[model samples]
Target: MKKIQFNLTFFLVVTAAACSNRYQTNNHTAANKADTVQSKYINQPLVSHIYTADPSAHVFNNRIYIYPSHDTATGAPGNEQGDHFDMMDYHVFSMDGVGSKVTDHGVALSLKDIPWAGRQLWAPDAAYANGKYYLYFPAKNKQDIFQIGVAVSDKPEGPFKAAAEPIKNSFSMDPAVFADDDGSHYMYFGGISGGQLQRWDNNVYHADATNKYGEELAVLPRMARLGKDMLSFAEPVKEIKIVDKNGNLFKAKDNDKRFFEAAWVHKYKGRYYFSYSTGDTHNICYAIGDNPYGPFTYQGIILHPVEGWTNHHSIVQFKNKWYLFYHDVQLSGHTHLRNIKVTELTYNADGTIVPIKAMK
Candidate 1:
């Protein structure tokens, strides 16, 4: 009887050990499933809580920060003039890394806070200089013209305070601030069609003027060095001329390769790369030049047409890898409403960028 009881006891002990081992294996599998959730959104919207577009990404203080335009649905009728875009505020977003949680720093700046701004607070970019963070944006003034403005904050993500007035001699839309390695800062801006680039002739707006669309050279984007104060232009805005491999300027009719809006600059291997969205065509193209003020030779498309009417983007390197931040209408399926996303960008050995197909 003693031998039989020992065998029963040993059997029970073995069963219990097996059950405990099985439980741990199942728990480990469950944890992996949670990680799969993170992997699934690799090319999806970085944030769904609020509509964001025109991502201007930067790596500040070892973290990735995105300053994007806050798109709102005001029920205004959509038109070629962009009357439907009624964005009134700016919200900044940040992430630790890819596949990490994104934090939406709500209401960094707003329309009401800008005393000189009338409406349509469009795309914006941020820069860190002079021990402060500068937010550069474009908005219509009381005169019903788009003028670039500057706001300042001590923190990268902040409730930035707008200046009392727009930057002196600043006009048109899309202000992209590029901080060079030599501690110099330059601002690139301008857009065609509804962006009103066509209305400006010689830095002066002619309300009755129209774009030179046929055989004429494309409407050029403008660049100006920011003053030491980081508030106004230090010199007159100069035109950025993009040319073909044969050294011929892209005519206005060459919509496929012309610059439309959303100018972004980044340095790689000591070469200045100027990239911008080809509006209407919905492609992001890039150029390479020895200097920031380019007659940058036209390279090729960085991104193909996304699932929307517009494509705006920014590129930055973080932790030894380059990534492209762009927006599309995938979430809402509305042109005015958009969601920002990021994907890894790779460069060829010849110093040209490999084109990426935009996320569906």
Candidate 2:
């Protein structure tokens, strides 16, 4: 009886193993089919009609909301002249489901609405915190000096009011906001020579200006901690750099500066990923890193300029699936009137992101 029982248990175990293998194989097959369908859909030209660019998107309540720089006239090509900046506006779009094509909702915020907003209101990033939706955008004053401003509304589609005066002492727009699991908030902005992070303290900052550039300069991509009230920083600023440009690691060029702008940082599965646009903004490239303050190694190109000069991008994940949200100027003819586009992002075994083809 004991021998018979042992043989029976062994047979049951073998059957279970076989069944598990079959289940995994079937699961993989189904996933591959879904991917093929998605690839076909993404390959289609998404924003062939309108000229919109500098996209910032967030997933809220199972829907994705995108805010992009909008062209004033429908079917009108963007004006690239310095004076053309005044024609730009901020428009919001939403989809009922994640990864769905965004439908235009007219204008959410416009340059004419803000009392002090200059002719050009550039890249805008939005976040939902507490009970309010906050938008951080770059606009010029009557003097035409560019500055960052904040607006608040109760809903994503909002008649948002300017919450505070334009943030002083910062340049190189494209502002992004990140709230960590610990309830701390950080704002990342600036461009090639303008990136920096600040701690929030009730919609205000103490303004730390101790870097080599001095206090008045707004350095791009600098990381700092936020205080309890969510308006100011709690620590000294740490400058983040890419690995290819790092003197300690690669020794590429002391001043050969590879562009790193439009930074979006997220911590996932014990690794912090910092994605930024590299090279020229018109010929934008992409790289990733494990640390927020890098040594960020070049992964590969996410989207290359198809009909235009460069690509500005943002990455967000919803429901365990990752999507790359970005803007391109195919229709606007290399002007700043960039249209928003979306594509699914896949990862390699070593955690590198797969390069996506530019939509035709």
Candidate 3:
């Protein structure tokens, strides 16, 4: 009787193992199918069928293209550490003009395709050069350190191919690339706290580093000119200095005006406009400078806070009208899950941007 019972127990265990394997395989197949499903929309909040945030809008071949981070329902609890934003893939959106239909080019890139990225594919920006479209993104490497990576595609909306590794000397998150009229391309990147900018104080990584408080010079974003190939940095990274109208560096206590993250550059009337988010304060602010690498003078806010805890954006001119592409949490009602939106940006004759109210 003991021998018969032992054999029956072994058979049951084998059956259970087989069933679990089958279940995992089926779930994997479903996820792959979902990744390729495409949707179209035209109204505000951009694409509603799926959650997207941190819009990086650009004009490619006269059409407006947006590269945004794909926000998923990761179920991780929200916190200052940003563990809740566990995005693993990206989607590209495009439209001919303001009221035209926007198409979702599904799954442009994913973590599985990236050799070095471990997780959290955050805000991304794109540039067109060298006869191809380059997508710049931030992801934590396998060692759990944040680094910027680049991918390329033949077309603007892409199923892009990532480089084998992250950019040399790249660190932190939110990478925005600006292609100057002179044919020079520069990348603006970095963020504080959870975005990991604090860790790289003085350009050296310190695991215990924290942002300075009141009166200490505010944390600055880093910029590097893209090499002629557009894949590497041409020079060592430099910190961008943003001063007040009186030419004084902002104190760390000036939360409303200091740079937190989301570096974007746009040229207007031959002057460089450097804009960024005031992280915890939740405002989109800008500064003006004579050149791309600045001593930018803080002007004022471009956008007031939206419903979410974070705000990120990009400014671009499509068909001669400038628009701001940004995101808020109106759709999911959750901070980590957000929807992208675009509104007309007005500039005064003096080049100061008229602050616009965010639409719910």
Candidate 4:
């Protein structure tokens, strides 16, 4: 009887050990599957041949399309003149498969169409709304006056045509358009000092300039509501201040304070995220705010001065994943050879963006 009992006890122990091993293996398999799912959702740009700068992208019909400031076949960058000074041009690139890789489709638009524009053209932003695609760009007049212009196309890849004359009397460049869920449209643009808020009117707004140059005299970081059509502002302009040079709360004439330019605002998970570059364009900085027109608080610098001198960025959500789109001087060098790069954006629990590391 004792020998029989020993044999049974040993068999039971062996069976329990085998079951434990099976459970451990299953757990590891599940963990690996989760990691794979997370990685697949994180979108990064695939390699491409074109060297472009100040890229603005919009995803539609399950494909991502990018438009950037023009670069000549000789690999020369455009917009040498002041903002709104150039005959605006842009190159079109598309991802092959959904999230596959970027390919240059060649020139989407050029200045020859707009005979009136001067020689300098700078940043460009594109968006799809109301069954049409719009490209917003800056161009100069014969008198060297800077203004924002719009081009519209039936499809994403476009021989876009100027919808109307340059929105006259607006100075700060880099025009970005955001259509809110409530059907209101807003256009944001500015540089160094701060950006402006204007209602989008197919025609232009005629307002007296508070400054000498006829530029809006208001401080940097401003916003205005747009009319239903997304062309003009709805209300008077309001200013947004994020941080000072000392990284404190913003105040007038704070030598250290920085305002918004290359500004983009998005609503995520019921919160508004406004991200803008600070310091100098060459040294891109960032900040965040709960409100669109913010009394925003400075989070920190996103991209510091590195191989390239300047950085201007945009953020987008594709396939439920967030990405940072910006230009870096990696291969192009000090010639400001800006090329578009896409990277994963991680977030903190406190609702701030994780700082980006400088490229090696």
Provide TM-scores for the models. 0.88, 0.70, 0.87, 0.70
- Candidate 2, residue 252: the lDDT equals 18
Residue-level lDDT of model 2, residues 37-143, one tens digit each, is 44533444345556677678788667888877665443443332234434456667788655466677666777777777666676788887778787778776776
Instruction: Please report how far candidate 1 places residue 351 from its true position, in Å.
Output: 0.8
Tell me the whole-model lDDT of each prediction, alpha carbons only. Answer: 0.92, 0.61, 0.91, 0.60
Worst 10 residues of 2 by lDDT: 248-257
Worst 10 residues of 3 by lDDT: 34-43
lDDT of 3: 0.91
Q: What is the C-alpha lDDT profile of model 3 across 141-220, one tens digit per residue? A: 98888999999999999999999999999999999999999999999999998998988967788988888799888889
Angstrom error of the Cα, residue 128, model 2: value is: 1.5
Candidate 3 lDDT score at position 183:
98
lDDT of 3 at 220: 90
